[model samples]
Target: MKNRSLRIFLKIALSTMLLTCIRPAPAPLPVILNSPVGETITAADITFSWQAQQPAAGYIIQVASDSNFRKIVVEETVSTASANLHLKTDGRYWWRVRARNESNIWGFWSEAAFFILQRFRVVGALKTQGYPHDLAILGNRLFIADGQAGLAIYDISIPEQPRLQGKYLDSLNVAWGVKARDSLVFLAYGYKELVIINAVRPESLKITGVLEYPQPGYGYALALRDSWVYIAAGAQFIAVDISQPAYPNLRFQYYYPRNCRGIAIENAYACVACEQLGIAVWKLDTFPPRQTETFDTDGNARGVDCRDGFITVADGRNGVIFLQQDQAGHLTELAALELNGYASAVTIEDTLVFVACGSGGVAVVNCADRANPFLIATITSPYAYKVGAIPGTDYFFVLDRDLGIVTVKKEF
Candidate 1:
């Protein structure tokens, strides 16, 4: 009877011990931290707080350099609701909390939380559709010339988030280039000539003037300066006097050896990039205009821009050619960098040059030294046709034949 009673007592004791072991220990204190935060937190030193599973004797907080809290940087025992932490540098930090009993047994670590510190500037990108050819910014608005679909206006007051204001679809041919001054918006439509519209009210853009080209297959490019408007027609460059915005008159036409694809004017000289003749510098100061000098290239030059004392040209076959401009306004070939594919357009700002290639994507070149240009980075789209850069923005706008318009932020 005594043995039986002893065996029963042993079984009951074992069962009670087994049940006590199976019951989960009180959960450790939980620490919740905020997230989706900035890299650099400039607020007053952060205060970390936590809630215990129950009224405890005290709490232990361990801040570690790693997510696992293996390398503890700070271990503190506090009996308050908050702990003051002063972080000096920027990096990812891990933290956890623990509760202790009067018997000096420490509880398990709570869930880990992390935070990061950053210092670099953040850049963003935006995308659009329909051949976005040229971008013209006026005040807080950005105007895009959408080929075939007409003109599209976007409110770029907020550079990061551009909103479409309105779109006008009144033309058949594609709108190639757009230039805005005051309340006037000049759109270059292939074969349709120049369409002038009043853009004061972007929501209600109305055609105010239409200047027709004398011949077909003309009016591919347009540039405006003061009261003069320069148009690049096939094999010829036409100048129009826009002193009277409502009535535009053909000032004159300068015949070149090959088709004029692009034109840019500075001072008294007009630089024209010709497909067959290379680049022709005309003396615009002359009454009828005379070709003063010409710089020949290996391939057809499609785009041209002048900055400081150097002229940059984009050849369809030869990547980019740097030409030095003399005091006489003459161009001398300095250096040429060969690109992967057919180069169509080029824009130079600060220390970077953006090249738009047909199927080769966009090539970014570091042109700090005009004598020795170096290719820095190349970002390609499926079929990038053209590229444009805003003067003061690091944002690059690309026109893709298949993807319409894609905006990329320059990380470098």
Candidate 2:
């Protein structure tokens, strides 16, 4: 009897071991609710829903100002498939849901989402072909200067969509730069010299003034501040006083050995970027001009702009360079960022700087700290040529050589 009992006990033990090895593990609980992500939705005043792997005893809903839920706003336990959440705030909010089994083990939280709340407003965008070099907005209309298309006008009364008003195609060479003040429009035609027209009437724009150059080499860029208008030629900077809109009087022409590509005016000073001459600064009051200060940038300078006490230069080789000028007019290099592609143009508003890169696309940088600038974002296209930003909006307009116009908005 003892031998038989020992043999039966061994067989039972072997059978128990085989059963344990073949059994499968239990499945994980499913995520019930998913958060929404958008720019127009600020609060969570909608229904939150989810799913489950097995039958759940109940679900726990938690809402917080942070993703970690360190500061909890709401904690509720419910058994239904949906819960109504009425948020009273107008900022970013985080929420998640958890399901509990009959054994009381809780599952993991769902993914987090963000939403921005604000008064929505429409923004305008302008683009063109044949190299859109410059843009100027006056009143409610936008003027674009196309390299080979002459002057193109658009009525931006409706910011979201701009309607083409007309195109003044008198100049066949190229419209390099444009400036509008009062009712007059000044255009720099490549070899056609400076052509002025009356832009007061949208239905009809007539040529009112023309300044011919003896030997014109494409007028590349221009800037207008107060009554003075500065134009960049091959190797010369021409200053014209536009106190009289109908007729622009030539003040003086300053010559540089290297070709000038971009020009900008700030208060009583004008900043010019010479391809090989580096950067030259001149006083608007002085006739025939002498350089107040010249910085030796070891790159081909393409665009320049000045604001406050800071000067920004777009160098094709070295990227974008930021320089600070003291009250005594002494210059010091603050920052130099090496962008992969060529930095073609630089424009600043408040603390934000927009750089147009030829192939790398348009880069937005935060210039809050002069010594250390941070690139916030980049808007890329097949061939991004120019970029412009609206003063009070998060919208940025980029002119792409092949993609046409691309409008970018900050989703956060």
Candidate 3:
């Protein structure tokens, strides 16, 4: 009787072990949302959201350039069901997610969700608390007059990954524009003054000099040539000689009736974007501006750039006006490129004019046929203020008020 009872106990123990070992793990299937399988994301940045899974300790998401996910670009394990990703390429991307249980065993991946991202694909972006109005780059360093957040600097050695190197905060006034040369950074601090920052070392900035305006307005735009800094201070065009960077000396000021927002200097002449007055040409080589010419715009003249003997003006709703300035200090309208969006900032490359169109992103205008300039491509963005091209590359830098600095490849 004892032997039979022992055998029976052994049999029961084996049966219990078999049952436990054969038990299958419960895997949860998470449904996809937002990034529908067949949808396309035009922007470079994408947000992936999904339905929550039950009995999950964490989640695993993979984003690959290929549908098979053979080469993964984004593989993350998180406790949340959402992921925001920034990609460098403009093409089809496959994404999928899986859940993990307390035992550390991962469930099968959910159905792959494939999507497309094209057009003005953002490859690099720097998001900050400050409002980025305008940006200037010298070598690998990027300087900006970041509105209320003050003057900011970043390392653009890797344009796709702009790392913040330093920042100087000014609470009393707003930083409207910035220009950097050698080791000096000239910042436009409203009409209060022009603040000169010694940025030989981006981490440690020094206020080497300040040039206050005679009147109360503020400094808006600046252009530097040789050692002279031509700036737009409210309704006046002023020049400061920075031969001694530590002590900038005011040279002269030319009062104009319109508000000056942007300034561009080429050779001995400087073009000022006198709002409502359109483009104001000044002979900087002579004192008191010598001679001046103004072009008519349908609306506000917010920005200006001089390139290849052409003066491109971002004339708000008036579109973009191309003016040809002669040695006589006179400007004649060459062409006008208009878009549905408001032109806020303008830059030129070859025959292409890149205009920052507020919420409409960047509008590329073809001026090859100067007499009939027209928009060729549009890069969409939620908030865009300024668009500038990298000196040696085909990439464009966009300063977005809310999204910070965005780097886009000018493929179109």
Candidate 4:
């Protein structure tokens, strides 16, 4: 009887050990941060979000100034997967999240994610005369379109202090747009004329030639190529022959039902931003360019710039827009990012795009990946009208209607 009892006890102990060895462990939960991850943000208000885990009752989020989370700035526990918070400081930050299971056991903390805020800084700024509308940089000189105050010239050899070198006031009308090269400068004079100036001697700028459009016309913007000047007039798009600056003549003129506000040229293609009509494109290989296609946009198309096969536009309230051009000179929308303020103009420099957002500020975008463009930084202003980038440098200039010329630099 004693041997049988001992045998039963041994069998029961062996069965218990076998069941414990075969049983499986619970699976680990995953917590992943979504947006603002590895991105540079300009706004103070941001939403922190993470993926929801199954069987999770709640989540804990923490933000820190250091990667090791030694200096924790925020720590909160919530039932939801997202939290809206305001960050008052501008710098690099690290964040992590973890979940609590229904059994009251906390999961492992997520791997730390990092991001940057306000990576740009105001390096210099100067007040200017008149309501500055647009700007052009030629070598060391800066030309400004100062509305009815005329055109103002400055020597930006020192970007911090743009000393006034010369200015021309058109008492009759306003200087709406400007473009300059070696010795010549083109001006869109109010609604009736395109004025050519001999800027070789800026202090004594003389109007060398003036092409007057018929009655009731608006000359809003202009673009310069080889020896031709393309004009975006309210209801018309005109191309003028500037081979002879002294006597400019019209080479091609076409009228559109929608108003044309801006113009840009790439290789043999010319694109005009036609307000509500979107974009109007022309093939310029022929003596008289022909309109090939028209594209519609979601917002008011105000300004544009194009290079290689990529096109960028500042769509009024819609912000910055990206486009692609095919071999046939056809254009298609790739992506559109809505930003703060009213986008009035855009300048494309290599992989970067600078947009002038009136009142909202100036936005710098990274377009290295055309299909996935994102904002790098934003420099706020009272009224930003136009933006221009200095070649070979990360420095860009913004023409503010209320504040004049503001210089911004991208910090590493």
| Clashing residue pairs found in predicted model 4 | none
> Which pairs clash (backbone N, Cα, C closer than 3 Å) in model 2?
32-50, 32-51
TM-score per candidate, in order? 0.67, 0.70, 0.70, 0.75
Highest TM-score among the candidates is held by which one?
4
Q: Candidate 1 on 1-412: residue-level lDDT in tens?
A: 9999999999999999999887754544454433322233433255677664465667777777688778876788887645777543334677777776555556777677776543212343455556666667776777887777778888765666678888777656778777889988887777766778888787887888778765744666677876877777666787878888777787787777657877777777777888998888877776677778898889989888777768888899888999988878888888899998888778777877778877887777778888888775567577676666655666656777776656666543
For residue 312, what is the lDDT in candidate 4? 89
RMSD of each: 13.6, 9.2, 16.1, 8.2
Clashing pairs in 1: 39-118, 148-174
Number of colliding residue pairs in model 4: 0
Candidate 2 worst ten-residue window by lDDT: 116-125
lDDT for model 4 comes to 0.84
**Local distance difference test, candidate 1:** 0.73
Candidate 3 residue pairs that clash: 190-218, 190-219, 191-217, 191-218, 191-219
Which residue window of length 10 is worst by lDDT in model 3? Answer: 27-36
Full-model lDDT for every candidate = 0.73, 0.73, 0.81, 0.84
165-273: candidate 4 lDDT, tens digit per residue = 8888779888888999888889987864588988878788898888886664577889888899999988889989999998998878888886888999888899999
- What ordering of candidates by lDDT runs from best to worst? 4, 3, 2, 1
Comparison by lDDT, 1 against 4, better one: 4
TM for candidate 2 is 0.70
